[model samples]
Target: MSTMGNSTNIFWQESPIGKLERQKLLNQKGCVVWITGLSGSGKSTLACSLSRELYTRGKLSYILDGDNLRHGLNKDLGFKADDRTENIRRVGEVAKLFADTGLICIASLISPYRKDRDACRAMLPDANFIEARLLEDGLHEHVRQEIQKAFTSLHVLERLKIFSPYLDLISLHSRSYIQPGFTGIDDPYEPPLNCEIEIQQKDGDCPTPGAMAGEVVSYLEEKGWDVYQQASGSNM
Candidate 1:
């Protein structure tokens, strides 16, 4: 027994069946595919596509869409920075559990903060945490230009400073012009520095949903997470 967070004298319960057994049963290695990006960046679309692609290949997969989870698991949480952090933490734990059951857990969220995402990555083995960043071409550049314009205005800076204590800086900045607390607008979205996969636009256009899903599936296959080996049966 030990103290953990608000709970006291809590203990971790061990399971009779281990992850290896579950993987054997499912014939695939357990892993988390975390897809992160700004709103309207097609994160959910890619997640659904990827899951469908895996299903067609006979691999088990599950999707944890951010908006969908808000209806239940994170219903109590708000959009404040701290609430967002807690929301991501809860989803990460759930995703980890699904992965342990030999399912490819796909988590699609805005997940603006880098530290929060990194904390989730630390929850699993290094290899099991696959960070996939989805973005549109020129999106980052456009955001950067907007941020620069915001910072250049002395009036905007003063207003932001006045509100900074009560609100997130990104929220304050964005609320002055566009949607408040919008990721990639006022809230900074930290892209993964060393992600396992990056799905982005090509030749000034985004690829079809199937092509995007195929890209992720190809990566999984290359990394050998698409299948598991069967035990020898001499009796047969």
Candidate 2:
């Protein structure tokens, strides 16, 4: 692995303005929200909804839809498995660039292959990769647990104090996000355990997206990002 990487090594030019400076100027941290689900599962909707929520709160964000990119950046790629993998690989790089600019990049892609998705996550620094699952048709409790167990292993790897990496992850799901052979179902899904947050769509006794948005906003605020917060009457 080391030899292969060395063989492919190329010069990495440093940007005059680094990620930290960019984030500081933008008053926000940049990261990628990789939204994956079956077609018509509302991944795009969730991305748009989350983007709007972020926008109102004074944060900048962008969306890279899988279908839309085929018209341009990924035009050369086809639907063959290999082509699809390459397509997603390019998208990952683009998403990382957007995140580096202090803009939250919402990448709504089918991204079916677990290995491919994991590879995309690996492209960025730890805690920068967030995988959001849209559960429209629903999931069995046991399966959810299994997926969570799989995800838990990946997240808790930053225990060492020295050179340890922090992770920021969350999962969201609901109805209208299901399909035959869809991820988390016929196909395998790796859900996150110990996620920072989770939003359930139309849960029997759950909160609405608006409520979840508030929760997310609160999280961002707590993290010191410049998010739009409602004016409070507190005089501290």
Which candidate number maximizes lDDT? 1
- lDDT, candidate 2, 91-188, per-residue tens: 99999999888898989898877777888889999878777765543444555555556454433543432232233232222222332244444455
lDDT (tens digit, per residue) of candidate 1 on 1-236: 66778888788989999999887777778899999987767798899999988777677889999989999999999888999999999999999999999889999999889999999999998799989998855765676566657655534656666555544666565556554466765677888898999999998787788998888888887898743233234310
Q: What TM-score, computed on C-alpha atoms, does each candidate reach?
A: 0.79, 0.65
Prediction 1 global C-alpha lDDT: 0.82
Clashes of 2: 7
What are the lDDT scores of the predictions, listed in order? 0.82, 0.68
Candidate 2 wrong stretches, greater than 4 Å: 1-10, 138-199, 203-236
**Each model's number of backbone clashes?**
1, 7
